[model samples]
Target: MFNVELTSERIARERLETRRKREAERQERIFKEKVRTIGVDVKALDMQVEEKKARKGAYVLLKADAEDRRYNFEACVHQNRQKKKSREMEKALVNYRHQHQMPSTRREFDLNDPDCYRKLDPGDAQMMLPGLAGEEQDSKSRLKRQKEQLREWLLCQQKELRQGKLRKKRVIKGMMAHSSMPWTWCLVCVPARTGESPPRACNRSFSSRSTRSRRRR
Candidate 1:
């Protein structure tokens, strides 16, 4: 029984020792620099980088495809607009030619007609007289208008001349009036004697004499 007990104890101690060794190994794996260093997982980071690069490449391709589609759409719209404009221009040209470019409306048709003189009525001969009577009437009217305009121009020139003469007369009259006015005299009294005061008066002749004397000096 003692040997059996000893064997059991030994077995339990061996299990405990094995468990302690495994715990120590686990701690070493968690705390050691080689196993738990201060750095990211290179494989995980590389995979993330590759994923980001793939996403960026896909975006670039999608953007380029969208731009190409947009350009093609705009080009197709522009082509359709141009085609419509060309069709409208062609239609307008065809309409214009049909309306105004008929052969009968052309001057050459009259010259080329074989019965050009035979188609004239009795009054048509007078109508084809090169409009000399109308030209004479227009000349008479033009001469009358020219005479009337010349009369009006002469009247206007005479009126302007009269106004200029009146303005000149007024200017000359103003100048003569200004020159004929009495001269202004400023009297500066001499310092009086201690007991005498002098009278102040308008002294035009005295001022004139003083002005002449200053001029002579």
Candidate 2:
């Protein structure tokens, strides 16, 4: 009876474990169907993940290519600099050799080379003018005539100024002589209480004196 009971218990436990595994599988299928009903495709998600991985791989290749190109460019620049330095050193050596007269035939400078100057105008580059002497004589005569005219003008201006001054001096002298006479305008505006006579008294006296002087003459 104990051995029979043990076999029965073992069989019941096996049955329960089998039911649990079946229920878990059933729940997983139901959840997958619900996700499909909502339009979530697992295949498309897998493709997107694959594309992202591909893009990451391409970016890494591109970065490597860029690094390689940069290193190549740096190498080329270094080579070019070495070539330039070598050329400069060669040029300096040649110049030093030329200055030391290592070569017997030295280059000579040519002054008469036609390439040194611009082309000359044929019409304007003719010989000296034949009438140069005659033109010089004419210019000299013209200058002398101009000098004479200028001198005459200055003389006329001086003579006019001298005559004007003489006329002004004579007028001033006449005015001074008339001022001592009592009948002048100098005494007319002055006060009568002064030593000088008034205008009316001096006029009558001068008129009478003029008649007397006229009779005596």
Candidate 3:
């Protein structure tokens, strides 16, 4: 009688173990389906994000380039004005020298002799044109500031490029994860999807042939 009871208990335990395995396998299948769906969704989301970022960066770069060009043009204009002003100053000094019989260069003029300063008419002497001088200095300062801003924008562009590349990589990796190619997706999703895995093509540890063999088995 005891032997029969023991046999019945062993059979019951075996049945329970089989039921547990079936339940676990069912859960695994559901999980794999969810993973595949999520992988495709993630890939789509990444692509959209990358495109948006690229568009934003392109506009920013265009504005930065325009500003850089504007600064360069202003600098050139100021440089030309500076040359014209120096020439005018030289001609004025020459005329003053001829009228007063004073030396041409400042080094030749005697600062101790009040006669040298008297040669240039105090009331009529035009000091530097305030408007022109101010404009020239303002242009130079603006050019310097714009150049610095351009450098910063260039660095930002570089960073955007890197981010764009990284996002592309993420999209590719997601594609590989969902691929149906043998050994490609299987290896990638294996540790993540053990039993009842999806038909993803992974390139994990195994070779193509071996991964296919495991899939068949």
For each candidate, the alpha-carbon lDDT, in order, equals 0.74, 0.70, 0.73
The reply for model 1, stretches above 4 Å from the true place, is 1-40, 109-217
Segments of candidate 2 deviating more than 4 angstroms: 1-4, 31-49, 52-60, 63-67, 74-78, 97-217
The C-alpha RMSD in Å for every predicted model, in order, reads 16.9, 20.8, 53.9
lDDT (Cα) of model 3: 0.73
Segments in model 3 whose C-alpha atoms lie over 4 Å from true places: 1-40, 102-217
Best by TM-score: 1
Tens digits of per-residue lDDT for model 3, 1-217: 4545688899999999999999988778777865434335777889999999999999999999999999999999999999999999999999988887655445745766667556778797776765654456567889999999999999999999997677656655764665565434432343332324444443344555675578899
lDDT, model 1, position 194: 25
Give per-residue CA lDDT, model 2, range 52-157, as digits (tens).
Answer: 9999999999999999999999999999999999999999999998888653433542355454345457665656777754567477889999999999999999
**lDDT at 136, model 1:** 77
lDDT winner among the candidates? Answer: 1
Residue pairs with clashing backbones, model 1 = none
Residue 122's lDDT in candidate 1: 69
TM match of model 2 to true structure: 0.31
Ranking by TM-score: 1, 2, 3
User: Candidate 2: minimum summed lDDT over ten consecutive residues — where?
Assistant: 185-194
